[model samples]
Target: MSAPQIVSGLAEIADRYDAVLCDIWGVIHNGRESFRDACVALARFQAERGPVILISNAPRPSPAVIEQLDGLGVQREAYARVVTSGDATRALLAERAPGPAFKLGPDRDDPLYEGTGVTFAPLEEARFIACTGPFDDETEEPNDYRERFEGAVARGLEMICANPDIVVQRGDKLIYCAGALAQLYEILGGKVEMAGKPFRAVYDICLEEAASRTKTPLDRSRVLCIGDGLPTDIRGANAQELDVLFVASGIHEAETLDAGGAIRAEAVESLLRQEGLKANWAMPDLVW
Candidate 1:
């Protein structure tokens, strides 16, 4: 059978799906700010009986996500509830025996270890490493931490990734995430664990949280996972057997139509075909 047609507007697709599992970074907002129209669109959908859950690979818990969203001007009512990989990571850390952890990430990611009782350790004394992103946001590459990563690997310290996205659009620039660092560590023979979409653990948390609020049990068929990233978001949805609404305006902005232009329906179809995964619907972005 031919793949489902790409929908032109988010509202059209929203009406069809009972629940929305949305990615935060590329869909609703960039790292800097939240999309006003997208937030409005989600609020409107919820008002119309559709439940919208903000599922993200943020290296912080739901409260932290909310605080960040609040800083970005996203209202609490815009989403039903928030679920993030950081919550799952915190849970995993809590279950393990307390060990000195070397955090190889940004300061914003520190909240992931909050209340987990995991002791922070210096690179030389760390028992394991928890990577969230580059130490500095201004750096183009992770070269600044090359020595630290190498040393960690040399000492045989295992690493845990809070976010599984390799790169994300921070305004007009693409910056590396924790997944990039984890990938590099693994290449050097250091053990690494990921906590996010396509990894099962994070998705399970999202589904469980969504299930609690939803009046009706979330059916895989009636759900739509909307996101921009192919490897993480689209592939994860496909694996879960849920229909997806691929928003081409975020990470794939260059390949969709043009930089910051509406994603053509045909282009979305072709792109999905190349990836061997079909989105049930497509929109230029979350704009209503």
Candidate 2:
């Protein structure tokens, strides 16, 4: 119940951790491009700390995430390894009883269903649904999929939510993600299996990857989670008993800062309290 200390840069807490699990989208890139300072900050952390794992809720595997990063111009040395919600979701699907599925996202997310032994089927023929997000997040909302979700429900198709982020910042706009649709599906009495942040399965995969790349049993207390999303990133970090470095300039800027861009510590603290969340530090943005 302590107020989060506002800091100027990652330097204030960088040395306190052995590994840093950083979010990719809002932290290192804004979906359309990379954040130069944030990328440099992570590179610096890897040089000083044991490892800096790129943890994201993207509904694709690490390879796909790396490819996207490359396209965004994120440097190769920014982090030690990439761990994604897609990787975790793939494992979940692999372990499940093989069945016909309807992929609910765009063609870019088709990689999730690859080599999983789960054949793709039409909505009526599907035994389950693998939801990535809206096919076109830029123009579509969660309600756009209402009829499809209803069809899945009528067919008794359980949903596997690859990315548990409800929404994410894409440049200046906030776009809905697979989690938002999954929540709506649940509201209509459909069963949902989530495989990303705020869920223990994805965190387990990330922590394991951190330990693997660093060649050390990463202490959860010494591992810091850096992210901008409150519901997914912050909530997930809190569930895993790790300290968080909340990026105030991201999605929550309007709620946590004043008109002049000053940190409204009390307001930030109040928001966290309302969400039953906590972060050890708060910085406008991640910097070296």
Candidate 3:
């Protein structure tokens, strides 16, 4: 039998799903700002009696995510609650701190370490490295950190990746993230750890947060996971046995989908077939 067809309109599938597990960086916003139409759609979903639980690989807690979203013009009421990788990282760091650490990303990304009591040291002096991204977003690429990873390894520093996204959409531009740095570091034989989705901890936290809000527990079957990244969002949802709605416009562009709108759809179907998982639907991207 042929695989299921991919639906491009979210509104067509919206009513079929009870809750939404949305990804923040790509579907709702680029790194610099929120997608206005996506936000409006989410608000409309909430208004229609469906709950929206935002799940992101962001390396900060919900409050920090809220602040970042606010700066990007996203209203708080767009979703019911938020879950982030940063919150999981912070919890992990707080539980295991006072360890000398080297931060590989920018100062803005350092908020994940706030109040964690983790001592920061240069690569030469640190026991571990908490990689968020390249030091300079404007100049550095993933390979640019090879030398630094070598240095950290030479010093016997283990690495922690705050975000595990290889690349993310930042206002029509693709930029490297902490995961790229960590992947490179791992390739060079550097010890690295991930604290986000596809890893059980972050998803567990999201589920817990979602449970706290509603008296009715979240039914995995009734939830719809919407996201841009195929590896993280789709794979993670499949692991939880939740339905998925792949958003092509976020990470993958429209051109990536072929004639009859079947290439991208077939790709997802093939992945699900291989993994023995299934997504209830797919969309180009969320629009108002």
The C-alpha RMSD of each candidate to the native structure, in angstroms, is 2.1, 1.4, 2.8
Ranking by lDDT: 2, 1, 3
TM-score for each candidate, following the candidate numbering: 0.91, 0.96, 0.88
Q: Going through the candidates in order, what is the number of backbone clashes in each? A: 0, 0, 2
- Candidate 1 stretches with Cα past 4 Å from truth are 1-4
- CA error at residue 149 for candidate 3, angstroms: 1.3
Cα lDDT listed for each candidate = 0.80, 0.88, 0.76
Per-residue lDDT over 1-288 for candidate 1, one digit per residue giving the tens place of the 0 to 100 score: 255566666777665677778889988889888888888888887777567888888888889888889999997778888988888788767765377888777787778888898887788988888788888756847666667778888988888888888889998889888888888888777888876876788778777766776788877677778899987898888888888888888888888865557667677777778988877777777865
Candidate 2 deviant stretches above 4 angstroms: none
lDDT of 2 by residue, 37-102 (tens): 999999888887778888899999889899989999999898888888998899778766477778
Q: Which lDDT tens digits does candidate 3 get at residues 78-162?
A: 8988888887788667665887787777877777887999988777777788877778766779877777778777776778888
> Which should have the higher lDDT, number 2 or number 3?
2
Give candidate 3's error at residue 59 in angstroms.
1.9
